[model samples]
Target: MMTNHICFIGGGNMAGSLISGLISNQYPTNKITVTDPDQQKLDQLKRQFSINTEIDNLKAVEASDVIVLAVKPQVLKVVCDNIKTATLKTKPLLISIAAGIRSTDIDRWLGGNNALVRCMPNTPALIQAGATGLFANTSTSDNQKNIADQILSSAGITLWVDNEAQLDAVTAVSGSGPAYFFLFLEAMQAAGKQLGLDESTAAKLAKQTALGAARMALEGDDDPTTLREKVTSKGGTTAAALASFENNNFNDIINQALTAARDRAIELADELGKD
Candidate 1:
């Protein structure tokens, strides 16, 4: 249970997901609060979760020990600036879910207070099946890091990186990874339909196959390459498919795509953090 009072700075989808996850896991509703400018959002969230709601950022920030900065990347600096004075007094552990904003920039925006954690969570978080990557500033205490981990782990699997730049790679791999898989699924479904199956059947086959393969990869002790080798007999159907993938340099294409995502992530930090 999250014993500490927690305040969310935004009442959007990501924030809603986290709150729902926490409530499902038996965290006290009374210990949580969410602040948003939108009255409709606050009403919906309050009705659904029964947590406290606030229109004033400073009042919300002052009342909580953990402040989740769940605002959009474009408005995160403004939110930080607005809460800087309150935070300087409260010293709440700030956890940011905004994309492409570095902890250093957040600290600087918050008047040099350094306790912050930057998190990247994918869309699957809504279903409590997310993969999140976190990077903490040097000023975060071990206990604070543990709290951050626990809070994020409520949503999905959590991974931590020592170097902040690794979060870029995390963004490329898991952050943008879901879309890559969806694209592959679309191609697979189309190919199945072309192979004389109906569209519904093709889609079911493609989606179930993807899900089963993922489960196998996660549950089995052996690595993915060995699992593939186990399934592929020489000159068999799987071998033919592998040959086609190799011929098209599928791995290189994936590398290029993820590299583009990581580069763009870094570029975004620069673009968003510029004076």
Candidate 2:
């Protein structure tokens, strides 16, 4: 068991995922602590996984060997400032999951650019199928990074980037990618309903299609575009549907949306820097 204590400053869904992953990986439960303002969430965390819990972020930071910041972007600085004031110079490896908050800002708020890892993990992590993008400051050691990879990979796949700037593109892609998929699923369900299927039936069919298609893409030899082409025969139903989407510039629309999301992510990062 790793002797280094792990602490999360929030007990929301993302934090819950990390905590669960840590416990499932047999990292010492006694060495992990989660802090959140909500007593019910804390209780759930404690009851579900036999781990230590706290309500005070400052206290949690003081007691950690690896501090995971899993709070919202808006309140990140507030939390970081409080942690800085309460924590000793003997710093822990700070890993943040707050989207759009840069490591430099975290280091600044924490008083210096010490061991810090900036990460963006999507909502899928809750189900242990997430893909996370991680980047670290110069102060982060290889051993610390290995530890981070272990903790993160427990939930899903993890990719580390050399340039933190690429994280904005990652935010546009995977970080917010799940919602895009859910939107497509929702539209499919709605279309099914319009085609006279009942709500539950429509939902089930849509979900199955989404899941099966994803599984096929994963298991199939062909690439996604090739597979799509395979299903879309000339003058077939899929072809007709794709033709309509093409007429509406579907690919361009998606590009525009992602570009907007990426710009917004960068803007948010800049805003966080200001605060």
Instruction: Encode model 2's per-residue lDDT on 94-162: one tens digit a residue.
Output: 898988989998898889957998998998999999999999999999999987887788788999999
- lDDT score, candidate 1, position 228: 96
Top lDDT prediction, candidate number: 1
Clashing residue pairs in all predictions, respectively, total: 0, 0
Question: Which lDDT values do the candidates have, in the order given?
Answer: 0.93, 0.88
Off by over 4 Å in 1: none
Local accuracy of candidate 1 as per-residue lDDT tens digits, 1-275: 44899999999999999999899989999999999999999999999999999999999998999999999999999998899999998898999999999999999999886689999999899899999999999899999999898888888999999999999999999999999999999999999999999999999999999999999999999899999999999999999999999999999999999999999999999998975
lDDT of 2: 0.88
Question: What C-alpha lDDT, on a 0 to 100 scale, does residue 199 get in candidate 1?
Answer: 99
User: Candidate 2: which pairs clash?
Assistant: none
> What ranges in model 2 sit over 4 Å off?
1-3, 85-88
TM-score of predicted structure 2: 0.93
* True-structure RMSD, every candidate: 0.8, 1.8
